[model samples]
Target: MINLKEIKNDLPAGIVVFLVAVPLCLGIAMASGAPLFSGIIAGIVGGIVVTLISGSQLGVSGPAAGLAVIVLQAIQGLGSYEVFLSAVVLAGAIQLALGFLKAGSIGYYFPTSVIKGMLSGIGVIIILKQIPHAFGYDSNYEGDVHFVQPSGGTTFSELFNAFNYITPGAILISGLSLAILIFWDQVLTKKHKVFQVIQGPLVVVVLGIVLNVVFANGFPQFALAASQLVELPVASSLNGFVQQFTLPDFSRVFTYDVLFLAGTIAIVASLETLLCLEATDKLDPYKRISPANKELVAQGVGNMVSGMIGGLPLTQVIVRSSANIQSGGRTKLSALIHGLLILCCVLLVPQVLNMIPLSSLAAILIVVGYKLAKPALFLGMYRSGWNQFLPFVVTVIAIVLTDLLTGIGIGMAVAIVNILRNNYKVSHYLYKDEKSITRDKYRMLLAEQISFLNKGNILQTLRKVPENVDLEIDLSKSAYIDPDVRELIEDFKETAVTKNINLTIKEIDRTTAPTDEKALL
Candidate 1:
C-alpha cells in the first residue's frame, strides 16, 4: 500500500528522528536508574517491532520519561533490575489481555479539553526541562520531565540555577543550532532541493560535533565538558556488544509483589500509550486515526521483545512522534528506519554519536516544545469560552506542577464538573408564552434521558408552580426515566390538588407503573 515517493519523504525524517531519539533514550535510561544500554535496546525494539505492527503511520515508540519515576521505584522495590525485567514481561502479557478484551475504547472517555491541555502542558514541560540542557547545565539527566528535580530544585528554580552556571560553549552551540533549525524550517526547505533530502536537526547535530571537535583541539577555551555530550556505552568488540543485552530473572516472575508491580506497569503504560496514540493522530497532517486496540497489541509485543533483550518498557512517545510529523515523515517506514539506524549506530560507530553535543538536541526539542505550547494556541483556546479555557489552563498548570497522569486527572476532574453544571441547568425547561390569556400556563419539557441528576430540577419546578396554574409535564420523547424521578412525579401528582394546580402529564402509563405507596416512598 506504500509508495516509493512516501518512502523518499520518510527517509530524511527518519534520520532526524533517530538523531533526536539517541540522547532521549540515553537520558531516560539514566533517569530510570537502569543500565543505559537498556534504553537503546528498547528504542530499537520500539522502532522496528512496534512500528511494523502499529496501525499508526507517524507515531514512534520508545521508553518514555513519564515512566521514569515508576521504573526507578520498581527497580528499587524488586531489589534488582533483572527482576524488574521479569515484571516487564508480565506487563506485556497483561497488555495483550487488555487488547484482546477491547479495552482501548477507554481512551474515548477522556475529554477533548483535557487532551488538548495535556498536549500543551507537555509542551511547557519539555521547554522547562530542556532549558538547563540548552545552557549546558547537566545536573539533571537528559530525559527528566518532572517539575521538581531529584536534586531538590523546582522547574522555575532550575532556570535560575542554569543562568548562574551557564556554559558559554554550550550557549553558543545551542544558539547556532536553534538558528539553523529555524532557517531550515522557514526558508531552506522551501528554497532548495537539498534541504528536502536533509533535515535541519541532522545538520545541527553534525555541525555540533564538528564545532565541539574544533573547540577541543584548536580553541580549548570554548571546549565543552564531557557531560555536555551524548554518552552511549562504547563497546570494544562483538562479545562486548552482546553482553549489553540482559536476561530477566524468571525465578521472581510469579511472586506476589512482582505480579502487583507488573499489573501497575501494564495499566500505566497502556494508559500512556493510548493517550499518545490520540495525541499523535491529532498531530498527523493526514488526520489518520490509529486503531487503539491494535496499538495495544503492538506495544504489548514490543514490550515482550524488549524484555527478552534487557530493554525498558515501550510506549508510543509523543516527542518522537511530533518530531516525525514536523519532519515530513509519510509512513511507518521512518520509524523502522530510525530503529535500524539505532542498531547500526550501536554496532558500528558509537564514537560518532558521542561526538554529538547535547545542546543541539535540546535546541531541536525547544523548537518542538514551542510548536506544542505556542502563545497562539493559548489565545485561541481562551477565545473559545470559559468551559474550554478553564480546563485547558488548569491542565497546563497541573502538568507543569505535577506529572503527566496527575495533571490529566486534575483536568478531567474540572471537565466533569463543567459537564455536571451544564446538565443541572439544561435538563428541563419551564416557560409560558406571552400571548397566553392565562399567565399561569407552565410547560415543563424533560430531556431525552432524565436520571437522578435531574431530580432536584424537577422538584424545584414543581414547587414553583403558582396557585391555580395549569402545569403540563412533557416526557413524550424521553426514552428512559429513572425510578426515583417517576416516584417524585407521582408524589407531585398527589400534592397537585393541595396547591389547586391543574396538572396534565403527557406520555404517562400509570396503569403499567408500580402503584404501591411503599415503592413511591
Candidate 2:
C-alpha cells in the first residue's frame, strides 16, 4: 500500500535519486552505443511500472551497468537497435515464465557471506570509479563497473590520470559538496526535523550549480567546461519528445539470432535482478524481505514496456537502489516518484538540469559507497569465523577484480566447497552402545539426508565390523538415504549371513522415508 504519510520523506528521496539517475541513464546508453533517450525511457518504465507490481519497497529498477557490455555487443551483432528491441521484448516473456515457474528461489542459494561481499565489492567500486569524475576527469562514462575501461584506462590508471587533467572547479565543487553532505547527514539531520525535510542532496546540487556560476565570473581558470556538468539533451518541442519513442520491429522477433539473444537476456537479467533484490532487502532499515517471484514479474513487465518503446534492457540496479535507501526512501512510492520526476524533468526543464555539476553527483555516490563498504563490516565478518569470513573476503576481492556476476560465481564456488568438506567427515555415527543387541554387538546410526558423498566413510566403518559378532543398523533416525548406500547395506546382509553374524535392521517410519525399506524388500 502507498502510505501518504511517508510522502514527505519519499518526495525528497525521489528528487535525490532522480538527480543521481539522469547522468547514469545517459552514460549507460552512450556506453551501450544506443540512443541516449532510450535510457531515460527505461528509467521511467522501471521506476513507475516495476514499483507498482514489485513487492520490494526500497529496490529501484533501471538500466544496469552490468548489462551495458552485453547491450553494446548485441546491438551490433543483431544488425540494428529495432531488432534488438524485439529480443528484449521476448526476454521479458521468458522472465515472466521463470517467475511463474518459481525460479526466484535462486535468491535463496546465495550464502550470507557472498551477499555481503557482493555489496561491499560494489561499494568499493563506486568510490574507485567516481574518484576520477570527482576530480574533473570525465573520460570514462558514469556507472561503468568493468575494470578495463571503455574509455581506454584501467580503474586505478584513471585515478592516476586524474592528477594530470584536474579541473580545479570540479575538485572544489566535489570537495565542498562532500563536506555539505557529511554535515547534513551527520549533524543537521540529528539536530532537527527541518534538516530531514530539507535534503542534503538537493542542497548539494543547488550549491554545486551556484559555485560553478560563481567560478565562471570570478575565477575563469577554475570554471568547468560543458563536459563537466549534467548534459541532458533538450527537445525543441512536444513533437521532438514524441519522436524519441521507437517501436520494436516485430517482423524479426522469430529469427534465430533474436531468439538466441532473448534467451541470453532472460538468463543474465534474471540473475542480476535476484542478486540486487537480495542485496536491497538486506539494506532495508526495516529488514523486510521482498517477494522474489513477484519482483521477477515486475521486472518482466517493466522490460516489456521499455522494449516496446525502444529502451535498453532493464534490471534491479544496486547503485540507484542503494542511493534510494541511503537517502531515506520508505516505500515503493519513492521509486514511483523518482520515475515521475525523471519524466517531468526530461519533458519540462532539460536546460535547467544540464547546469548541475557531475562533481556534485560524484560526491553523493562516494558517500553512498562508504555506507555500503564500511570498515566495521569487515571486522564483524572476520569475527564470525573463517568458514564465513573466507568466502566473504574472496567474493569482495573477486568482484573488485572482475564484474559482479563473475565475482559472485567465484564466491559461491568457495562457499560450496566449504559445505562439501564439512559434509564429508560427519555422515554417520558408529559406536558401541548399551542399546546394542548383546555385549559383543555394535550399533550403526545413519545421518539424516545422506548423499553419495558420504558413502566412503560408511564403507570404511562397515569393513571394520567383526564378522562373528552381532550388529545392529538403525534407520529410525535417518531420512532419504541414497540408493548407493542402500545397495551397499544390502550386500553386507549377505556377507553377514555367510560369516554367521546376527544382523538386526531397525525400521524407520514408512511415511517419512519409504526408500529406506527398499533394502529389506
TM per model? Answer: 0.95, 0.93
Can you write out model 1's per-residue Cα lDDT over 1-521, one digit (the tens) per residue? 33456877899989989998988999999999999999999999999999998898999999989888989999998899999999999899899889989999898888778888888998898899888988999788776778888878888899899998888889999999999999898999999888988889888998899999999999998889988999999999999999999999999899998999889889999999999889888888888999999999999998989998899998999889988988889899999999999999999999889988999999999998899998999999999999999998999999999888889989989999998888888888888845568646788888888889889988997898888878889987676789999999999987889988888889856566656775578
State in Å the error of residue 277, model 1. 0.6
Error of 2 at 43 (Å): 0.6
Model 1 clash tally?
0
Worst 10 residues of 1 by lDDT: 510-519
- Per-model root-mean-square deviation over C-alphas: 4.3, 3.4
Query: What is the overall TM-score of model 2 with all chains considered together?
Result: 0.93
Model 2 lDDT per residue over 1-521, tens place: 77778998898988889999999999999899999999999999988999899999999988988888999999989889999999999999999989988999999889999999999999999999999999999988888888887556688898899999999899999999999999999999999999998889999999999999999999999899999988877889999999998999988889898999999998999999999999999999999999999988988888899999999889999999999999899998899999999999999999989999999999999999999999999999999999899999999999888889999999999999988877877787888766655547888988877899888888998888887888889988876789998898999999889877788988686676646358579
TM-score of 1: 0.95
lDDT of 1 at 378: 95
